[model samples]
Target: MTESSLSISVLLVCRDSAETSLITEVMRKFGISVRHSVETEALELVKYQKFEAAVVDFNVPLASMILDQLHGSASNKTAVTFAILNGKSGRASSLKVRASFVLHRPLSPSLMYRTLQAAYGMILHERRRYFRCPIVVPVTLQKGAESEKTSAHSVNISQNGLAVSTPVPLGPGTSVAAQFKLPQLPPTIAAEAAVRWYRDGKAGLLFLSLDPSLRSELSEWLSRRMEAFLRPVQ
Candidate 1:
């Protein structure tokens, strides 16, 4: 996807309206959509919705608990989180809460902008892991030396793995070499992949070893496909 199309969803848990306004303004400039929640309803929202990042105000009675729940939630365990503090002393304390970063009281637009800029790359990287692009592509899988290769067609592709359907019986944890060329890409991509799951002639393969260059190429291809497919029906 183009840089302009890049966006992140954030859960804002600040009780202070003025503070939330400042935070949202800065986040909006960076293409981030914030879901603001008051302390009373924050916990329920945290349990269900998935967010790329969360900004919490520590003054609220439930703020620390919200951060704890975010880390404990299976879907949000790796989400980036920020703690809003009223003093510098709270900075050290926020670390114990496992916050990814800390923002001192009296937020400024420039500081917020800079902070988001620094975090954009990491947030995008995390999002890519879960972005799946559906496409059919011929894939060749080999178990080991001297073994015959199996031909398969991929059902979907993600940054770390691909799901494919083949007649060969593949058990979980079976290591195999995978080779395929993405659409519109001239070079073929090859990687060592291990079977993550299999059922009824279909299997999920987690890439074990992919060259950095080829991985980048595949990621770009998937991003472009996803962007085009998800475009609004204008």
Candidate 2:
């Protein structure tokens, strides 16, 4: 993979200045942007921002708690996580924390680069799911056989759900059948979705029953869109 051509955002939680500098430098080389945070503030940041990956230092007092928060967060649960261990002794504990990768202490640039390369694919896959593409498309929503169909326009779309603006917003917990077409996807994507939230004439629909093939198509479409924006015109 051409690591430098990809765009990835990571949450770096390490209080050690020396280690932080080394990690930051290595990540930059791979075209990944790091948002540095201490263990205390990292928990809150994970709740709000969407990151493809996170690197936490196990030596931090609240490191485990921060990892818990990251995995528990709805927005960040799937984020690829890396645990920085001071020595081999922390390996077993790091496994329990479920970090996607582990970096041992006395981290060298070569070691960091290798680990990042190993996790790069997973990071991109997670990043693709978090990416929201803005496109207005006509969408038909039907709650049930007896209910009237609602016509709405999509505000934005992600791998798991869609945000749509409607004349009347559907209430949360409402189940609906959605049918819409993406730019290059030949067939109309139809899936059963649940209304996750509603506000100000808009509702968020979580796709609960999308077919695997359709999901693959949607993922590919979104990846293309992301690459288009990130890559310069040729």
Candidate 3:
């Protein structure tokens, strides 16, 4: 549960055996393992087990039922679910298929790969945000035409960014030098960051130019946080 990977269990739902078989095999080639389950029982599986994604045929009547069952359920809440619809039917059901991405049938392999990649990232990003740690750390932000520097405290930290509590919040697009150190990391990490959004005294900074070394360090730190976050509370 702590370590993450591109590898994820997928729920494959479709009426046609050939389409499901082709898609499942293609997913395996991309290093994504999947489990094809009947729609009748898949909802219960989705509710009780962890599935990172689901590929469904939008044309099937059961597809909507699967979506309805898993939409807010814990197992599928953050799972990346996408549908395959006929090109002509894409528009009609665009509003109906509750998927993270919708690809037309007669699917392009390249496009599907890229779509799944994006969906995987989105799923992981949401998971991190949900498990963000509430740890305050020293933060120094430098910004503006005057190169003004300010002291702040990180309110919460995730792999992507940290929300900062500063005396003065900068504009949304202001670029800055962000410096901080987490307990899991040794040296102070500095990165070129930008204010993503600001409200009142808090601003969220997205690290922009993190070097590979620093990114590796940060990734390790985040992995540790993930482990701690997923530990069952006794």
Clashes of each: 0, 0, 0
lDDT-based ranking, best first?
A: 2, 1, 3
Q: Give stretches of model 2 more than 4 Å off.
A: 1-8, 47-50, 71-78, 87-98, 142-151, 208-213, 226-234
Tens-digit lDDT string for candidate 3 (19-55): 7777776676544567887878886787886676788
Instruction: Report model 3's TM-score to 2 decimal places.
Output: 0.52
Candidate 1 ranges with C-alpha deviation above 4 Å:
1-7, 16-22, 35-50, 72-78, 87-98, 128-136, 141-152, 165-171, 174-177, 198-202, 209-234
lDDT of 2 by residue, 74-118 (tens): 989999999899777876676677788988887888999899889
Higher lDDT: candidate 1 or 2?
2
Residue pairs in candidate 3 whose N, alpha carbon or C atoms collide under 3 angstroms? none
Q: Over the stretch 73-150, how does candidate 1's per-residue lDDT look in tens digits?
A: 887889988888877777667667668888886788887878887887776666665777777999999999789999
- Give the top-scoring candidate (TM-score): 2
Candidate 3 off by > 4 Å: 1-6, 126-234
Residue 24 local lDDT, model 2: 94
How far in Å is the alpha carbon of 70 misplaced in model 1?
Answer: 3.2
Q: What is the lDDT of residue 37 in candidate 3?
A: 79
How good is model 2 by TM-score?
A: 0.73
Inter-residue clash pairs, candidate 2: none
